[model samples]
Target: MHLELHIKSGSRSGEVIRLNEVGSQLEPSSWVKENEVIELLLRAPAKFQSATLNLYDHRVAATYVDFDENHTNFVWKPQRQKNRSLECLFINYFGLAELSVELEDEEESKVIKNFAPLEVFASKLNAQNVEDMLSYLATLGDEQLHSLFQTTKHGAGFKEGSTSPNGSLERLEHTIDKLSFLFQSLFSKPITKLLPEHRVLQASGEEDLDDSALGWLLDNLSVVEEVDDIDRAHFEFNDRMYKAHSVQVPVLKESSNLYENQVVHGFIVTLLNEADKQLTNYNRTGSLKSAFSEEMPEGYSSFFTQVNRFKKELLGNQIERCVRAIDRLKFLKHSLDKAIPVTNYILDRPILTQKAEAQQSYRGVFIEYINWFERSCPDWSVYQNLLAIKSIPTLFESYTYYRIGESLNNILNPTKKGQKPIGSLMHDIDGNEISLIREPTYWMPKNSRSNESLYINSEGKVLKSGKVKPRSSQHKYSHRCPDVVIEVRKENRPSKLIVLDAKYTYPTLAFSKYLPECTMKYVHGIHNRSNNKNLVCSMTIVHPMGDADESLQSFHSLDYSIEGSMPVSPSLQALGLQLGLSQDSDRLGETLKLLLKQAGVAIPENLQLPLFIS
Candidate 1:
């Protein structure tokens, strides 16, 4: 029997692949049966040499497939003759081809063997024809395109501790401990003030000296000279003449409750105690029986019940302890204020300094604990609402930004082979630690302006100098802010500006097309201000997705041409190129390199391999 391989799907108009020679047909004389092993030589099409052949259950590498003459032979074992198919997947490049084969019975093959004419087939893989295939792949879920993109631990810091048992909870407990210690230290010292004291002067050896002592002395003073043995009385009268003495006495102030530290400490204590009680209640009765026991959504009831049970059983006691510790911190903060004297300058300055430092340190610890709680706890809403602590989105945004930057850093300046990129923690201007940065600074050329320069004042409008004429005394200034702005400077050459914005959505075709319009707006805004059209070289939107269209494209206006693109790969190649890293450029990478070359800086050689590849 002869089997004719039919293209069922995944085939382009000009795609081609070669199979091992079998006289251009599988004849019954050499038909392979079930449980038989056969070697099939296959050659990758010229344009798809990077493609890998995927059998029903195995992947065959095609790196050695010859484009010149002979094909690469693949050993295939057929366990069953039911259904079988072959697929070719090109990496980095796009296009896929599939072939289906069915074995025919001897009687069926003999009926049409003589008159049937065989048709030969071949095709080529190119950029234009593969758009639909790429688009289709883009629509697929991430799991379906697993071979196309790679995932690395290099940039996923949040996930590092995700596997540990109650890791976030443990961290929160530790931070609480630190905060408690700091508060305890602060309250151990109290403030004291000196107050004037009025006390009646008494004879040194008076044992029963009561209110009558002063009265007796005053009575004897009137008859001082009448009595002969009046010497002691005279002395008493003189001593009584001194009346009440004024002495400085050290006294503890009652203003401890009014202090900021005390207030914060009390707040922390109340919050911790409340949380502890709630957690304990949940632990005892289960979350379903606790305050949040209201009927849940249809399908989520069981899932949420299980989650609540885990939180109550696993994290309840630990959280209770953390709350107790926070309460102790309040006592500590209060006690420290009352114990330290306000007049003891030597101890006063240091105490104030320590208090300030401890307050800040405790704040940081609480913030970290809060972050952990928000992530791990099922009833975090209670704590957040009670404490009035708001969760910041900037933290996650900052993490995303840092991961992107770190990925680029690793690609351009890798510390070690196979090292994954890590996220960075940063502090904002208000000393409130945040990861997302509206203005990020780089150590490269100091001549680079910040993203804030793109905007006008506080409004997010592009600054225009002469346009609309200045309103009265108002002056127009550029505040052109992009998410990230990098300036590359070379000796005796003008700097080049590369702008990047981070979006949490997948960079689809629609998003890709919209990015250029946004870039044009910023470019026009800048041009209106400086009248310099050559400042910005490129602008891009970075997102997380796979199988997106070519991210880089050029756009032209009356004054200047700017390149715009969206990078969806997590491997960092797109980011590295945009940041001016020089390497073998292809499409998007080429556009970035060309822009950087124009600025007169050459990127050094570095290994830019994908984190995961099939």
Candidate 2:
């Protein structure tokens, strides 16, 4: 009795295994029950999942399949994440088979015995049709792919905690992660949708079509070193090591000259494609290892072989976009006019004026940059790096000095409206740091509250705090005397407010475990021990490189949890950004801009000193 069996793997494919040549009575063993999940690592196994193999249970839907000897077939059905349902699909045995997934409802049970895919692929991968086989393997399902074998740690630098990607690793890791997902998807789906009863004949699996003509489809990497091992022939084309090879200096002088002439055409299109392939290959197989076009894993060959199909298409699309037409900048200019025409920076404040330095806030800095941006680059392209930084959310205040006008590398470029908010710090009109702010804070809270006091030389030490609720109906939260506070002293411009917080989460700074009370205690206890001045100028409670992760959100709960530390951005900075709103590429772009728009604030511009002739 040929029982129709449904297979259960996380995938949508099937595998044909000899369950047992022993059952001459030919009945499937009850021990091999239905809906049983047999995980073969991340792949499917060699058995079916159903009891009545010929009579369908109608529950299994397939995602992928394994075709054996061009005749026997095993198809996989991916598990549905939402419903927890599974699919049973037919496996395509031959070339360029589209993974067609089908759900087996009770109504389709009558045709259970006819579920077969190899017959269709058989027609495609026949002796006379060897050429199509390579293309078919090129279209290999995604699930069948895996990286060349790097431990999880090898890719660590690309993760959030480590230093950001700079050199080749950045591009490589991106491609690996991208291709991993892409390949995994292919492996997890149905490979062919052959009608039941199709007798797919078996053909010799290895065909002569594995020739060089089909191998060139992967992204065109500038061959640093290449050879065809098939003939044991040594032919060096573009020979150079990648790490030793710098984008700054092309390894091959000829290639460099060619690139120089076609830079605009190269960088965006071929360069990106080649870069994509180079990275993916390096990520999968180490840079010193074999090329990605070599072959899939061992068991992957049984089901489908084509792998880099989508990658090839992706390269083609990029090339078409790059050499086709450079979008007109004038057309982009007209688009910006819809917003309010701010005369000064979007955020206006004195750049480094004494009064400006006196204020410890981000709203002021955002205004300063907005003012600077408009005046400095009235013709600034919409795609500038400073603008890109705004997409990140919480940015380091220090980045402001270092980042400006860097060329846009597409890998790091933020999408059109998705940059991070700007970083915040108190700067003197001269752009010198008067003090550092731990978080982005709104200088003005709705109901507009601030803490002002005249200290009468109190013996008590702790920095006092004020918590004034907002009176304005539009404002919701009350303003608290800055998260931390300091008393005005005689040497310091007293009658002044030193409303700021110290940035602590930074390892360089004291951690949060030493926050509030202990910090306040130190402030009240220490004075005149080191500095010549009798007074400490100002005070603040901030984390270095203030970020929302350090400030607003809890660092403890993140997947990459930082134990006992505050998030990168302070809550105050977030709240203030919420209040005075502004855009910095460091801050996620839209929110910052929205907040900035709401505050109607702008950064102070760099103005020429008033000429004074005595």
> How many clashes in each candidate?
29, 147
Model 2: which ten-residue window has the lowest total lDDT?
A: 143-152
> Please, what are the lDDT tens digits per residue for candidate 1 over residues 1-614?
22222222332322322333333553222111111122333332233323333432124433333445533222232223224543222111111122222212223221111211221111221222122222332232222222111121112222322322223344445655666665554455432234443343343332333455545545545332322333323233432423222222233434433233333444345445544654454344323222222432222122223334334444456556656655655565455445532322121111223344355543543444344434532322212221121111121233234334443334333443223323233222222221222343221111233332332222233322224433221222233345554455444454455556554333452254446554554433333132343555555565433343344433333123333243221111122122112222324334334443333334344454443333
* Top-lDDT structure, candidate number: 1
TM-score result, candidate 1: 0.31
Task: Summing lDDT over every window of 10 consecutive residues in candidate 1, give the lowest-scoring window.
Answer: 386-395
In order, candidate lDDTs are 0.34, 0.25
TM-scores vs. true structure, each candidate: 0.31, 0.17
Instruction: Name the lDDT value of residue 423 in candidate 1.
Output: 26
- In angstroms, give how far residue 123 of model 2 lies from its true place: 61
Model 2 bad stretches (over 4 Å): 1-265, 269-433, 439-520, 525-529, 532-614
